[model samples]
Target: MDDLDLPTAAPATIEEFRDRLTEITDGLPRRLRQCADHIAANIDRIAVSTVAELAAGADVPPSAVMRFCQILGYSGFSEMQKLFREAYAPGFPDYSTRLKNLKDGGAGSPSALLAEFIEAGRLSLEALAKSADETALAQAVSVLAGADMVHVIGLRRAFPVATYLAYVFEKMSVPAMLHDGVGKLDRRHALRAGDAVLAITFAPYSEETIALAQDARDRGLPVVALTDRPTSPL
Candidate 1:
């Protein structure tokens, strides 16, 4: 049988690599998902085992193992292994443990933590106020108010936000669809020009959710994107 028929292999491509990483870390918290992506992208430069080995070590499945390799643009697990073997090195300052170091200086005190959180919120509000155009918001709200169908899509960390938006829209007597999964999406129904989409995403955005947004936009739906960063691809 050819290599394509092999039980323990996967396609090599950047898309594949990203998909695999996402699948392997599907249910993880946002922080853990970021950590997984960071590790997968740098796997070539880090001392790691085979795709299977690494997946097992990372407590993920073999498919997720090969998917991680594919996301990095390798042909398959073998090619990823070769690159990893050639460039493998390791170093770190135990960054997670360093959070404990802050407590030594009273940085972990409740008052200090509260101050940091408040500052973060202030910075976020300031950035949003500076970057978001009032005209765009008004236009989007107008489109939403008049659309025959409004779809809200979000994944992982952003899913809760989408749900809340859907609930609010429902209370306002708007026909809103909240797509948190494949089963929730009714793509068979034709989405026309008057339809509106609200897509919420954050850094390390979910590929599926992004694709859904693109598909809606292609179908002539007006898309209003809510993202943590202005430069986010939606």
Candidate 2:
């Protein structure tokens, strides 16, 4: 059969997915194992949902879902689902079976759970360390440090990060503004040339953040973005 016509198969039950998860993550860290469990439990729903919708259904952040996909040897959720659909050709594993395997697979000890958590964190940091661009990070920091006025914009969940950056910059004697909330018009009025705007946004990019960044750019401000994707609107 052609790739598209391959019968779309997923674990019929969460229990069967858990069993396969164990085999796939035999040597993985504890946190990742737990994340795998989360994915297994929700894979059926997630396979057919958008990233944002899947994250909400899984009760985890979108980044977590993306990270889980990466762990499963897929570039992202879309690719992961293609493999999942292909693998479960005849039929999907039963949900009850998958859950049973998860319940039965553990030692039920705090120490064991703790070990898994630590290992997961270790693996996550290692992966990030290997992938991060130090040069780009340095350039971003330099831009912030030397800016005449720093305008920070983050919408939705990213708003907290922008607020924290504004607070920290204040403490450091750097001129920064966190323009969020209803009073953004007043803040926007204050932007000027030679200023730098550090925008933090993610997919399903925030319209307000994009607007502000665009406005700043029109006024000759330098725009630097911190986003999940390199091609984000900001």
Candidate 3:
């Protein structure tokens, strides 16, 4: 909520923009906050979306959308769009095609794909090692180890990891329950006084996971969250 009298430098990268957004969004006025939320949630569409479309999605006027962009240090919407367009250049193959080819087992060699996946996993582990808090990790371990039961929940892309955790817990003779939201079931009722929650989610988090975690917190149950960043609402 500055005076908006001075021009600000634009963030150099999309990741930098996200870091800045996380830093400033909570302090913004309601309309601008809506713009931030909408943009963050639908980031992949930014290069193709118009000012009017973004405004409509945010339920704000076009002027507010422009102002939101300005607040993020863009001269206007075009400058912001330029950044995204450069990141998602038209020259590269789209993700869907690559995924389809992988599914068909026809485009890339298996060894190449295996190397790619292994490299990705290695990088992810390195990033986690750099950012993880040792004390917090120990606390989480203690909490889950002591809980009467651990309720695990993750959906969409996070579903596989959550299911794997639940499976491992069971094999180790540790009590665990997975809230898969099957048939849209409301499993928040399964949370109990002595239970803990292990919530795994990422950006644009699943609402059901957040709700269940919140419910567990409200009941004074311990909640260990595995999410993307500190700013995430897990």
Candidate 4:
């Protein structure tokens, strides 16, 4: 049922590349490090720009870029470009471009809306499948399962997830509570030494979530953060 014969390779997907980049990029030589940082920040340009254009923007020689590609298991600049293109793919529009398109009627019909939703969900799943670390997940499960209680907090967009997790935890008889700011209550009062916390937020991280996370840490609770980026405040 599986491809038992597939050859092992370095960074098979954009998500894998990113995971490996975080762990290994810092130790790379100066030339490769520059190239890596440039591409990380300018992902939108990778799918459409030429090697020379990218190299110029990265301020490194084209050969150095090629060398970096080789380090990631690509055959050459073209091969590396193929991998680079995957992350911002299909149309490769920047966030502003996508926002503008939405405002300017990119999905003017039900069919267009459905297709857009499908594509977005598919990409999100693809990223999660490729990027989520199994060990981290296992560790989280161990901690939460062993905790006397789990304090789950998610504000605004993440509120639904928080509420649902709290429900499920209670159903599983894992003493837990959702910090929903009900009655203007200070949620930290609910935490105890044996309790743990799980906070969820995304970019432009919510101040409330950040404060809660900080408080949980200050109270010596095991805290887990669910957010969009590694640099998330939560």
Candidate 5:
């Protein structure tokens, strides 16, 4: 929003665009920061959304949206939109269309749905295997194994993973605690010296888990995070 110089060339890919956005969004003025946060969180909508629609979502004026685009090294909103369109507009079916097709093909049946879920899980595990860092993983295992206690915290979609981890640790005779945060309870005070943290989260990460993990790290505990991607804020 300031009258700072900006580059003319747009980011060539969505990943670059996102990295740039993450790098610059916090330094922007209030209105432009609003635009950046909205755009980052709703990137898939940009290809089809109008300037007015995006502005409303950001709770800023259309002029502010245009200025935000310029700040991101685009000529304007249209140029930014073109970038997203080029990235996501090629033969990608929307979820509604996919669901409709599944229903029509009787793929909504229980067995078919189970098979779909199994295949999806397999693909996710395969990707995880391909991307895992053995050295970092080994370091994490060493930290957990050496710790007096391991504090596990994950909520929402990540809760099951945390619970299973706790169960596994218990069965293996490891000292571990799972922070479920039931009834708005705060269990962060239980974190003690000689403890380590295992934080599990994905996109739209659990704030409670992050806060607790940060608390542990601030107290000099080693934190080994399990997240979806490198850019994830764990």
Candidate 6:
């Protein structure tokens, strides 16, 4: 297998981390592959897993876990663990413990479920606001406005955002094209240099979207992507 070079920066989100991990699974050594499989299958446990503990669960040695972390551009297992913890677990009792608490709720009511959902949404929005880069958002809007035509490409988890962007652009009388890539048809031939592409994708990224984004860049299109991390192929 060829050596994989990970981005220098930590992944911006857990979904982006998974996308990169999926890319390397087929090329990993057998022990590392086991580690990958275990991590993917048991995301809920990853936040709390130690190098030794996770290695034991995956039936690999601690050294293999370290090697896996190094291949992903981390100093060691702990650095990578920190990113996952921040993304999904957020430093508290583990998810299973929380679920157990919910089941054993001593002071519960019908409205408690509603409160739980509302609180979850509030926390999610706060996290998003905290993580947002104002400069980046400004640059994105500027670039989109400057393009001759804006092409939006996203599939699976990102499709709704892509469609909404195209819809909004059309409403404003902007020249916009949404590439749903139905049946994986050939669409790159239609793109030109003056166009801008707004691509959105996360974990298990749509291969078709990545390929099209690459095509746009190769043809000199300015691609403004909304992705979980810099490593997103788009």
Query: What local distance difference test score does each model get?
Result: 0.62, 0.66, 0.82, 0.74, 0.81, 0.78
Report the C-alpha displacement of residue 98, candidate 4, in angstroms. Answer: 6.5
Query: Residue 173, candidate 6: how far off, in angstroms?
Result: 3.7
RMSD of each: 11.7, 13.8, 6.3, 7.4, 5.2, 6.2
Model 1 segments more than 4 A misplaced: 1-107, 182-193, 228-231
Instruction: Write model 1 residue lDDT over 120-219, tens digit each, in one string.
Output: 4665455346435677689988988889989888889998999999999999899988877866655625556778888898878877678878888778
- Give the clashing pairs for model 1: 17-70, 17-71, 18-71
Write the residue-wise lDDT of candidate 2 on 83-196 in tens digits. 546544323333434445546797378897677556556654553564366777898898888888999889799989999998999999999888886654657887877789
- Look at candidate 5 and tell me the lDDT of residue 218: 90
Which number leads on lDDT?
Answer: 3
Q: Which regions of candidate 4 deviate over 4 angstroms?
A: 1-83, 86-108
Top candidate, metric TM-score = 5
193-215, model 4: which lDDT tens digit per residue?
88888899865567888898899
- Alpha carbon deviation, residue 77, candidate 4 (Å): 11
All candidates' TM-scores?
0.48, 0.50, 0.58, 0.62, 0.64, 0.61
Model 6 C-alpha lDDT versus the unseen true structure: 0.78
* Candidate 1 lDDT score at position 50: 55
- The candidate with the higher lDDT, 3 or 6, is 3
Clashes of 1: 3
Which wins on TM-score, candidate 1 or candidate 6? 6
Model 5 weakest lDDT span, ten residues long: 90-99
Worst 10 residues of 2 by lDDT: 2-11
The worst-scoring run of ten residues by lDDT in candidate 3 lies at 90-99
TM-score of structure candidate 6 = 0.61
Task: Arrange candidates, best lDDT first.
Answer: 3, 5, 6, 4, 2, 1
TM-score of candidate 3 on Cα atoms, chains taken together: 0.58
